[model samples]
Target: MIRLSRIPHQLLTWGIPMGPLMLLRTRGRHSGLLRTVPIATLRHDGHHWLVSPFGDTHWVRNLRADARAELGRGHRFRPVRLVEVDDDRKLEILHAYRGAFGLVPFVRDAFDADAGAEPHVFAREAHRHPAFLIQPAG
Candidate 1:
């Protein structure tokens, strides 16, 4: 995991064309070691949301311990909190992403490319995956 502390490097990575990766910095819950990881993200409603296609990764664990984190999206550093969406609304949110980003096939393949499952199946599984709706701290 690459912990990004420099704003310039972050910008260079995300700012460039085809740079969709975001650098998330968090403090380890038990080890207290600062860790950084790259993730896919989408911006919405003046906030950024990150979804872990792999589910509950290390960065997610770190954020769970401490909501405070620095998001490096294309050289932009914004302090944000990891907000867990209500389970009741998880499917709705996932659907919104699918519609907004045209991610039906993409998400389906992410969950199980070989399962030959429907979009609903993928959506249901995606709900179980860890996701963070980021909001900047005032």
Candidate 2:
């Protein structure tokens, strides 16, 4: 259902804004097939980020096995290296994600921390939601 909803946004031209959503393409660990899903990104502290509001999901597992993935916004897809952010550095990203997207019910419900919660609140909540910093792949 989520994938279906994102198809239109995936087709839009790169110049147009599509909010924070992007199509994440990962190679399946078991099947070795390419899997795609729409996910929200956090652009914080001069870096692009990927946060799994739902915790460690399938895509997260796949990405763990293969850091090589593609992030597609509209018609433009770029190869990216997804480095799982360490807990120490993840607090700010989590806070930023909450501040930016916490209004959405799903995102809000995913964490125990409130939108205006302090950094430590997010630090405790960070384990449930894995975050990755997106870097341009060589």
Candidate 3:
């Protein structure tokens, strides 16, 4: 599974456009070490955003502990602050994300929304997938 996940990361590292994917670097809340993972990304409401497709994973917990993180593309990484999106706004972003990448099997499986689910359908599953807005960090 880890090997398979690295494929896209490798592609991204090679400067291939993998469609809304990026390398997220975060400080381990407990270990106090840097951890990086490749995850999907989105642009909503004129802001950069990301979602935890698997729900409350390690990275999410780390971010909750410390909002400071890095958003990276290939070899380039920059400082960024992550803000947890509110439920109301998260629903909209989730809907938009589904609309944009719904055809991808994993993305489709992440939500309760079906192939043609309406925006409200996403609202039902919004809490399960945490969404964060990326901001420039000082």
- Per-structure clash totals for the candidates: 2, 0, 0
Error of 2 at 65 (Å): 0.3
User: Candidates ranked by TM-score, best first?
Assistant: 3, 2, 1
The local distance difference test score of each candidate is: 0.63, 0.84, 0.84
- Report the C-alpha displacement of residue 99, candidate 2, in angstroms: 0.6
In model 1, where do residues sit more than 4 Å from their true spots? Answer: 1-19, 44-47, 73-76, 96-108, 112-123
Query: Per-residue lDDT tens digits of candidate 1, residues 1-138?
Result: 234325544554566533445677788999998776666576655656777655777887888889898867455667878887756545545544444445535555455423433335545476456767887765
TM, every model: 0.65, 0.87, 0.89
Off by over 4 Å in 3: none
RMSD of each: 5.4, 2.5, 1.7
RMSD of 3: 1.7
Top model number, lDDT: 2
lDDT of 3 at 16: 78
Candidate 3: deviation at residue 9, Å? 1.8
Measured on C-alpha atoms, candidate 1 has an lDDT of 0.63
